[model samples]
Target: MVKYLIRRILVSIPTLIAISIVIFTILALAPGDPMGEFALNSGITAEVRENIRRSLGLDQPTHIRYIKWVTAFISGDMGYSFTSRLEVSSLIFQRLPVTLWIVGFAYLLGALLAVPLGVISALKRNSAFDMVLTTLVFFGFSLPTFFTSLLLIIIFSVQLKWLPFIYNDTLQLTDFNSFIELIKQSIMPIFVLGLWQTAVLMRFVRSEILENIHKDYVRTAYAKGLPNYIVIIRHVLRNALIPVVTLLALDIPSIFTGALVTEKVFRIPGIGALLIDSINSRDTPVVMSITFIYGILIVIFNLIADILYGLLDPRVSSTK
Candidate 1:
């Protein structure tokens, strides 16, 4: 297992390099210039602009700039953001925890709800409860995230007054004093993400459970006088969870990028919102840094999934 993990980490180096190359190439070719924002702002002359350009190494050839950026990135210096005039790494570090809180809570809550709901629906197949859940799942899957967030805000925040309408605090990374308030602010966004993820996860769980329940192993368990609950829990749910694990492993990283629309709608500060702002401002350092971080996360999460797959199912060995 250790050897496999090491090998996976090794493989990720080239994979990330390739991803960075592609991201850098695409962004470099994009229509906007990072210096353009400075040009538009008042009291900035051509000399000032040229000085700014020189400081950013933007006056150099594109290839030279990319090479310098790549080298700096490899050394863990992600460069300075042109718009914010802050270190890219520092900015990401400040916002990462907020995103983790939302993503982590949503993932756990979504999976917990999805598993039980799926099991109940599958066990009581064709019942009213099952029908209702299925219908709701369809709607949940169909609705866009931004629209869903809006509806949730309107119903829960505006009409019901259960939670705040917006989360606009200056979140500090080092402070734990505002933890309670942070959690309260996160509830709506977490629910919005959770509800959507639950719909998809439930469908996967329901399908896998229904298929496994009919297998010979399940029948043999029943024939051996095992209780229905035991058969379902030990035999059914165990095997049914493997695919859900894969889906979860892939889906979690998406929250980092996928929450852009939801964050915008809720006025929540997160990595997704940062990504959009970086893109709009054409802040190459911020954009490249975030992309690199994302690529690293994907590689790490996928490796974790593979390792978990081997652990969960002994039939899938590390050697294989």
Candidate 2:
């Protein structure tokens, strides 16, 4: 397992480089000049403008600029935001806590709820509860999160007036009242993200459990006078969870990405909202930084999933 992990880590280096190259190429080609204002200013001399462009590395070739970017990133300097005039890393750090609090918690809540719900639904099969849950699961993921956000806002914020529609970023959690306010404001957005992810996870878990439950091993365990619960827990869950782990690995990094639409609707200051603003302002530094972070997360989580395959099922050879 350790050898396999080391090998995977070695493989990830080139994979990340390839991903960075693609991201850098796309961002470099994207329409937007950071120094467009200087070019448009009649009073600015052409020499001064060229000098500024040179300073910003805009005068360099795309490949040269990419090399510089990677070097700076490795040196722990994420460059400055074109609009904010602040370091890109600093800006992202400022917003990281907010995204983690909301989106991270939502993902955790969804994953936890999905396991039991899926198990019960599969166990019950075609019972009324199973049928209802299946129907709900179908609609849960079928409806977009943004739509759910709107519906939730209308019901809870407008009609019922039970919760705040807009998130309060400035409200420091210095007191119990402030904490309660945060919870009230966070409910809708969290629910929207959580519901969607829960539906997706539950459906997959239910299918996996149902398939594994009828296998020869499960029948043999039952024939040996093992309890139904023991057979399902010991025999069924281990194999069933392998694929679920893969699914979870794919979904977990999304907490860092944040829910773009839900955050926007709730007026939350998060990485997703920052990404949106950067794109609109044509702030390539921030945009590239966020996308690169996402690429890194994908590679990391995929590696984790592979490592877990060996742990979850001994049949899955790690060295292979």
TM-scores, all candidates, are 0.88, 0.96
Off by over 4 Å in 2: 37-47
Which 10-residue window of candidate 1 scores lowest in summed lDDT? 168-177
Could you give candidate 1's per-residue lDDT for residues 1-320 as a string of tens digits? 67776777788789988988898889888897778877777889989999988987878887898888889887999998888899988888777777777766787788889999999999999999999999999898889988888898888888998877687658554667577667767888898889888999999999999989899999999999999999999889988988888888888787564477877787767788889998888888888888877887788788888888777777665456
For candidate 2, write residues 1-320 as lDDT tens digits: 77777888999999999999999999899887887767788999999988977888988999999999999998989999878989999999999999999999999999999999999999999999999999999999999988999999999999999999999899998999998999999988889989998999999899999999998988899999999888888889888989999999988778998889989999999999999999988888999999999999999999999888988875565447
> Best candidate per TM-score, number?
2
Residue pairs that clash (backbone atoms under 3 angstroms), model 2: none
Q: Which TM-score value belongs to model 1?
A: 0.88
